[model samples]
Target: MSSRPWTILGVSTFAQTAASASMSGAPFLIPALHHQGLTVAQASLLVAAPVAGVMLTLVAWGWFADHVGERVALMAGLSLTVLADVGAAFAHSHLLLGICWLIAGASAAAVPSASGRVVVGWFPPHRRGLAMGIRQMAQPAGLAVASATLPAVAAAYDLRTALLIPAAFAAAALVAVAIWVVDPPRGERTAHVATNPYRGDLFLTRVHVVSVLLVIPQFVVWTFSLVWLVDGRGWAPAAAGLAVSIANLLGAFGRIAAGQLSDAVASRMRPIRWIAYAAAATMTILGLIAGGPIWVAVAVMFIASVLTVADNGLAFTAVAERAGPWWSGRALGVQNTSQFLASAIVAPLGGLAITHLGFGWTFGLAAIPALAAIALVPVRDERPLS
Candidate 1:
């Protein structure tokens, strides 16, 4: 075996991390937005804009990766993300800011499906779990960076200046991807022979639904943790941000561990089901303690954050593997689209829930989706990869 796959994995991880920084990093700005006089729901709407953009364009980018190539898609997408982020930095009004971030997220949508295909294409079945696990680390790693820096910067300087962080990362990633990303070779196919993986079964659909269900709890924790710490528990913004950042780091490690477990068991769906159970239990525990002592709430929130996210890499790998090369890009795109579609809605609704119901009730309600996801995990549909 060659070291090329490892190198490619590094580039893919960086590209996705940059994109994630630009996309998933918006919620970190909610605290800053609050300081600017926006209400909770309004601030959440701004945070949801990028995710809505991501939901809108993921499939098209997947199609592009399948038809053109991963390298072109990566370079083109990252470049546009950099430009959009730059535009967002100078936006004067909330509408303009939302639009610019929407554009950034739309462009950055290229990273997930394309980079995912790159990993699936390069790594063989035996090593794919670990590889995808490392690759999946990008989201939380990006979030960790955002958590540690964005709130602090916005507090110190201005929101506009803090907005530049994602752009800088995307620009750096563009350079790396242009220099290092070579699209993996594809198998030759006859015009009439390519088959659609979705036509014959409900496996991919079930996985997508399960992912959608699971994302609600994940986003509930991720989008609200800092605010919950500050607004609900009376912590300082910087300390809350630090705590959230540490939680994200633990979540990242949790994903890697979940991936390794999948490799060991030779089943992605199994671990996902188990994680769903853990996520349900954690969310319930957090809800029970949401109004309790500050220390207990913070600790439970951290654990909920970690458990809620552990299923992402496993579900992603299963979708790509089952979809095969001919359909993996589109399938993975669907997977991301379903999750982000839920994510886009969760912010505003969750904010409203927290507003009327308080953190305790809202968090208690978040457990419902996680509980639902446990039953839809599609464990029996799994087949061993080569």
Candidate 2:
């Protein structure tokens, strides 16, 4: 109800954006990796490194957040990210760079694992949807930052120099959070406070599964859009990067719109279900038109970016609200772990598929998972936030 929660949300969003830049932003370096003689599939593996690391460590970070506090978790994670980024910036070998990225990803997991809890703890249910929606903007906003800067920097300088961008973001965020972020107050511990939200129902599990399915298309779009534009359409790398950056910026707003819709409808699952349907339809349409006019394909790609990411805040709010305050951190960890697990696989497989099947068919195939997610949304299982 006060400006304080909004301030916390702002800092938390920036922190997560820093982490997202380290995690998802790595893909922007794919062109540089290709010029270094790595194949598309191989370059995608490097892009996958951070996501795989995030998948491995999210639950541990979540547990740390639950036991410690969001501010502590964020500061620790961002600090480690800065260190890992420095290692990545100086690493000469591909293997060493991948390892550094993995470490950065693992460390950056704290932002998402803890930040969602910060929003939920601070905002009431009626406004939590919008607040979390704004919080969810961090991902696409991070991608936008990466898309706009990393490719240009990599093309102008060396890959090592470009790698410092995320490190700078993390360092700046570390300072902001250290100065501004305050952990939301908690109620006194009771038996109910410690109870596991996953015990009695399949709700959390279903949400996780749906989220994983949705992540395939989301990652596919972000990971491949730049390459698709440059290599497939014969656009300049800088031009492609600019387009991707604009798309991601628009996608960030889509998250806010989805969040506001959830608040209006008072149901997180419903909007997610609709988003799944929209994603499936968009992917199918994009595939069908992939060989069509360039303008049309780009337009559809932009739309796909918006629809694919719209459900994140809705699902995120659902998970934390369902899990309750005590367990929300770990619950969010599980939620992100599932999505990142799918994301980790999406790159190499997507690259391989793009190589063999072409971007159109591979993108069309992404709709299958989005369609699957629709049925698994668990619309009836949602409960009012405590």
Candidate 3:
């Protein structure tokens, strides 16, 4: 176990954090946007814009990563994202802001799709689960930072100033990756090797479907958590921000733990299936208790939040392994594309449902996708080439 792998993991994690900052932090901007006169539904669309951008370009970036390499793809993506973030910070109108966020989303797609390839390439199968888990933590960790800081920053100054936070992160990540990250060595593939992973395998298909289904609940909860806390439960803005930040922080740990669990059990599907079941159970419970006491609803939401995102590392490890080194980037892109597509839908739709249906019914409806994910996920794990 050389320190090189860990170094790659550390740098990649920072890169992911930077890449994801804008979209993950978008929720934190909602309160300020609401104050600026956007309705919940409109604000939700703002949150969904970047994700929509990511959904659109994820596969292309993944393909680029596979064709070129992780380092180049990551550097290019982060650089573009930084420009988008800066443009977003200065945008005067909602339309301009949304366009900038859309660009940010498109560019940031490079980080997750490529970063996963980096981890899979650098670490062995035995240790890859944990490495990937740590890598996966970057999303929630970025969200956690945004949740904790962005609201207050926006409150203190303005939305534009707060937007610079992600820009700074993107710049820092660009520097880190440019200097430290390198792609692992690749061996020549045989002429008979299949380049397109979707041809004969149902594994990637099932994993992608399950991940897409699972992301609905994840984004629904994430996009509206602060509003739900403040408006639904009567908490102050700062307190709600703190609660969501804490949940995201815990979600990061959950990713790491879920990865280690897969490694310990020597099966990726098991942990993912377990996460789906757990997500279903928790989300169902959340619906049941949605109108209950504030403390109780908060507790249930916390559980649902943690369980919803816990499957990322597990499913990602499964996908990367099944795709092998050859198609890992594109496969991961497809996987994330599906999930982000689901997420793009979840944000605005969930917000609309919350506006019309109330949190109780909306949460109950959100649980349906988690239930679907449980049925969609494969029962057994696929074996990967060493």
Candidate 4:
């Protein structure tokens, strides 16, 4: 009870988790829409809003965290996100839905920036890897909640209530952070200094490169898995949601274990490389196997989810360590920006891929990024480009 900021971290984690869980509603959406008589054109636009919203503001949030400090950024963003979520629930027009989702996407950035800053600030350099890893678990945990509960809630109650669930969750995080998250005191002069990583000799050039490379599959599988399960394999939304939820449960543990392994191993990238290799191989195999049987496809995706995401913790830790303290926030922000930017692209492309190339070949293309990430793991710290 005394060490309760961690619980605050837990709440912060929940906010992010809830935001991510929103994708679960994607698969359930059309059925709920039958009552509204939404045309394909309108449904497409609404489905695209959250993805667009997240991409639009992710960089802004990162920049703010790099300059202003995470606590202020997180509180501000969380407040806006709560507003966005609640307001979206009541939105009656298509235009309002898009506007609400865009705001929600933008607001969601606050927690990651602030929470990451907290882990970076409090944890020592060596242990920072593990701390950051623990923080990443929020995503999978949130995805699990969305996948497991959101659709069911929508079916039993209504889509508005389902949307409200995550809104309330984000609100809880806002209140918890307000009460519990303590910012490290900086000298009046150095407070701004702590926010940016550009000044130092310690900027992580290799870490940055690897970060951009690694985020591809994580983003791909994350954004595509449920849609792939439902569209490609013909699984019901409820079933697909459950499968992704299980995959996310595995991912939550994978984040912690990857971080610990990064600290314990003599070489940080070694285990990371192995995880990348596994993800690539799994994707390739699953992509080829997708046409064979539904159960087989389901099993393959679940396995691929585990292998693909296991490296997220190690990746963040590597960037933080390589950047050192002065540059950690900015370094991580750059890392996130690259990855999430890719995530932004992946969603629409995935939709197009399913629309055009069919899921089999599009999924096969995703494996290419995983393999590229695996190949890059051999690179060591070259001189900092910065």
Candidate 5:
């Protein structure tokens, strides 16, 4: 492949990293907000607000990408996210803050929906798993950034000021997308395309269902990691933040590794199936040792975080390849929408579980979806158009 595709991947990664910063940063703010005045339920709702927003518009953004192309879609989405982040920074009340984050979430949906299309369009089938893996790294990369910086920023200045960090990330991504990203050439489309991906095969449906199931444990860990570290482990918030940051950093590498593993094995579903099972096992172990020694808990959480995220690149590649170039955007959008909807539920449900049932039981229960995902993965792995 030409360097052009790599260039596009670089730009998309930056934009995705920026888009993830704001949404991922929200969970880090929960402790600060709870300290200020909000109840655990209210803070959990705030943590979930962006994902809820993403759920509302993921398909729309995907459709927009299909119609207008990746560059335009990403630019518009990032621009809107920048505006929303700025508004969120100045928000005076929790309601106003939630509203702004919701808008930002909806806008940020464009990054994943469109960027996946960009990769599938530019890279050949043989190279796509690695490319998608690199592209998928954007979220964890952004989350790592947020985990490393947001807690300290919120601690030193205040939660409101901390909001500016992601706003800056959004603005940076906006500029990058405007200057660098280009839609792939039109010839990438397959000859006999479906009018909509949903109409043709059960492949896309299976991928979507598995993705939703897999996301439950991922979100449960992401949503509660910092608080669990601090409250359950009795570590300082900053120290907990550092651990989460490390986990996210490792998770980024895990995504790339999983992608390469798929490419090596020549089967996307193979790697994803293994990842799901690993996620279930690790999460179960983490649940069992929830109040164990600090090193042990951190070790299990780190492993769980890596395994939970490892499936994204593999699953995304499967969807894009199956959907073909024509429907890649919308198919990916649907995939993400399903995952985000699950993620939106996870925050509140996990929060309530943490409050009432304790982290041990919640972590144990979170593993069931991963087990379900393992069962779902045996459905056909071939591209729908092939």
Candidate 6:
């Protein structure tokens, strides 16, 4: 079966948007819970539970996509996500909600792994940077939905009903995957290698290091950016949420733009060298954002988000390119595993850093990872580091 790149792109955008709504749901839900008398700390746990669940299953889903096709995994994941949303809607206890969220987290993870595999499979090498970026945009686009609707829904109606949007969206994606998703012909791929790859050892391979290090900053921003806005800049939840939403919207564009730019580079490093540099420069600017006015800080956050997330596709292309067709799934699996493991640790650590150090340090520390990813880039062709 031959799949259109655009069709796979559509699947990615839709599925990611739906799953991303869940990512945005936590911060949005916190406000609704605050109105219900829950403390900010307590409210965040509701979201965190599911995220932890997602971290646990990320690698598993990657392996699954490597073995099965991206289409099958996406269909199953989205269907399960719909069901999990139903459970989340009904769970009265925080414990049950945590469990439901965990289930949702694991299921939601499938979209990233599956969506990415589809893009890498459908597009050619020259087109992959842009294509993967387009695919990565689904994240911020999805966040935009959460930002725009989640607060209003939880406010006007109950939190239960507010979640229905993601549920319905997931259901639609299930059908879309069933009907629309297909693998491209082998002839369409840029370079054909093995048709099967192993999952266990993809991590120690040189190229996978970029995937590991890139997530350090990604998790940092994702976990703490809202906290910084509210605590550091004194922005309200509505304002903070909206700012984050806007940042995500712009961030989506950044992914596509950065992807295209990365592809344009002639270096064997492709995006790694460039992305590493951009991430450091941008995050450094963001750390300095604390002294600026709120609106400016907001803009900085948006821009930083763009830089932070830009590496999403470029790194994936490296994996697919280096690993060959058979290894893409395992490669992606390792990528997801490392990124989310960092995410799981970083998310809570972000919260802790705010309580201990000041807000500036929260963003400032991310530079460490940005530099690390850059350093990981091989300086010479076929050198050891890459």
C-alpha RMSD for every candidate: 1.1, 0.8, 1.3, 3.8, 1.6, 3.8
- Per model, state how many residue pairs clash: 0, 0, 0, 2, 0, 2
Which candidate do you rate higher for lDDT, 4 or 6? 6
lDDT (10s digit) by residue, model 4, range 1-386 = 24654665565566567666442234335435534676433454466566566656665676677567767887898888888888888988768866877778767765665677666666655565566677888878887877777666766788888778768877787777777777754345456645444545433555555565666666566666765766566777677778888988888888887877766664467877888777778878877887878778878877877777777766666665555555555666666666666666665666567667776776678888777766566445432212
Whole-model lDDT values for every prediction: 0.91, 0.93, 0.86, 0.67, 0.87, 0.72
User: In candidate 2, residue 284 scores what lDDT?
Assistant: 95
User: Residue 265 in model 1: shift from native, Å?
Assistant: 0.4
- Clashing residue pairs in candidate 2 are none
| Candidate 2 residue-wise lDDT, 1-386, digit = tens | 68999999999999989999998899999999999999999999888999998999999999999989999999999999999999999998999999999999999998997889999999999999999999999999999999999999999888888999999999999999999999889888789878999998999999999999998999889999999998889888789999999999999999999999999999999999999999999999988887789999999999999999999999999999888778889999999999999999999999999989999998899999999998899989888654
Single out the weakest 10-residue window by summed lDDT for candidate 2: 377-386
Q: Per-residue alpha-carbon lDDT of model 6 for 81-138, expressed as tens digits?
A: 9999889889897789778888887888888877777877787777777888888888
TM-score for every candidate vs. truth? 0.98, 0.99, 0.97, 0.85, 0.97, 0.87
For candidate 4, the 10 contiguous residues with the lowest summed lDDT are 377-386
lDDT per residue as tens, model 1, 285-350: 898999898888889988998899999999999999888777787899999999999999999999
The residue-by-residue lDDT of candidate 5 on 21-102, one tens digit each, is: 8766799888888888887777998889998998888889988998889999999999999999999999999899999999
- C-alpha lDDT of residue 244 in model 6: 74
Model 3, span 89-139: residue lDDT tens: 999899999999999999999899899999988998888878888999888
RMSD of 1: 1.1
- Model 3 alpha-carbon drift over 4 Å, by segment: 384-386
TM-score for candidate 6, residues paired by index? 0.87
